[model samples]
Target: MGTWQLVLVGLVMLLGLLGVLVPGVPGPLLVWAGILWWSMSEKTTPAWGVLIGATALLLVNHVVKWLLPARRLKGVGVTRQTVLWAGASAIVGFFVVPLIGAVLGFIAGIYGAERVRLGGHGEAWAATRTIMRAVGTSVLVELVACLLVLGAWMGAVIHG
Candidate 1:
């Protein structure tokens, strides 16, 4: 591929990483699309194996995130409702205040709900801290997921 094409791919990869920091962007999907666009441009297309692996790398990050957390949460005694509320708040927050609001909103909503359910501000704050930790880890996991997509794209270039 031309140097310009590689530059564009690099830009897409950067955007994918940025999307990880800000909520609501489909980072992995965008990364995959960018890589696929490049792969299709080459005369000798990327191997089917490499393409499949890249797709899996793009796909499995989300799947593992969803499955692993729910299982671990069950082991640790956090309810599904807590997770649901956190997600809902995150979504609502995006509309309400945009950008950083979603992250804060999720944490605040979880804490608020826990306080109402627990009936003590102190206990509620503690539960909120726990939820905050979980959300933070999830964000980190997402960062790693985007990195994996970048790796897969590079691998396609090297091995194709």
Candidate 2:
């Protein structure tokens, strides 16, 4: 890739990393797309290897991000409906309040769902904490994976 292309790819990857934090941004997908673009453009062994590795990492991330939280939630007796509610609420909150509102809305949504289902504040709060923990862990995993992918891209760039 040309120097300008590499720079552009880097900028796009950076945006992807930030997308990991921002709701509805499709962060992992963006990162993958950038990497794929660069790799195809370069058509080198290192680039291909990095692309494959990143593909695996992202695949694992997607699976685990859903599974771990779901398992934990199930273990704690959290219903799928509650999770759905939280996600729906988070979407609404994102539109209603923007940035921070999504987080706030998610918490509120989960709590509201749990409260309605369980009919107890304490139980709802406990479930909310567990959900938050799971979310945090998923985000952390995604962030790390994205960073690793970025590193791989940079390494290919440098070594290419």
Candidate 3:
């Protein structure tokens, strides 16, 4: 039913929003799902080329982001234990506190881990800053992509 399609679109939207909060679960991926579903329905099939191009853009963004400083993640000068503890703490923070806590969790994780493992608050903080900057860059890139996806969806709707 047409309404069911809309429901999937809404699910896509929810996933996209949550994806913003949590890494790994991607927002654009969900948006693409909505796009695909809507297109399959007798909806104005937004050009496949546009969809493919947008996906290509996301791929490029991913590659470029990889080139950037790895933030809050494992890497040189960062031990596996450090990364693992950081993640574990963040997960706990999510349930223990809530929205803001989850965010603070990462920062605290690094600080706590390094302070214990590396025994240097300064070094730990430097890593934290680097990670935050990378995270910021990632969010900006995703925001732009999300805007494009929305525009494409809207175009399909209006033109159809």
Cα RMSD to the true fold for all candidates: 2.7, 1.3, 3.5
Instruction: Give the C-alpha miss distance for residue 62 in model 2, angstroms.
Output: 1.4
* Model 1 worst lDDT window (10 residues): 42-51
Top-lDDT candidate index: 2
lDDT of 3 by residue, 5-110 (tens): 6667757856775685575567767767766666656533355654676677767766766665454355536777766777887788888887666677877887
- Higher-TM-score candidate among 1 and 2? 2
- Overall lDDT per candidate, in order of appearance: 0.73, 0.90, 0.68
Tens digit of per-residue lDDT, candidate 1, span 1-160: 7889888987987897888777788777777777676767764545345456668875777877667656655654666677778789888887898678798778877876777778899988877776666656766787887787677667777776
The candidates, ranked best first by lDDT, are 2, 1, 3
The C-alpha stretches of model 3 lying farther than 4 A from their native spots are 1-11, 14-18, 23-25, 43-45, 65-76
Give me the runs in candidate 2 sitting further than 4 Å from their true place: none
Summarize candidate 2's per-residue lDDT along 1-160 as a digit string, tens digits.
Answer: 6889888888888999999988788899999999999989989889889999999999999988778877777888988899889999998998899679989889999999999998999988998999889888888889999999999888878777
- lDDT winner between candidates 1 and 2: 2
Candidates in descending TM-score order: 2, 1, 3
Best by the TM-score measure: 2
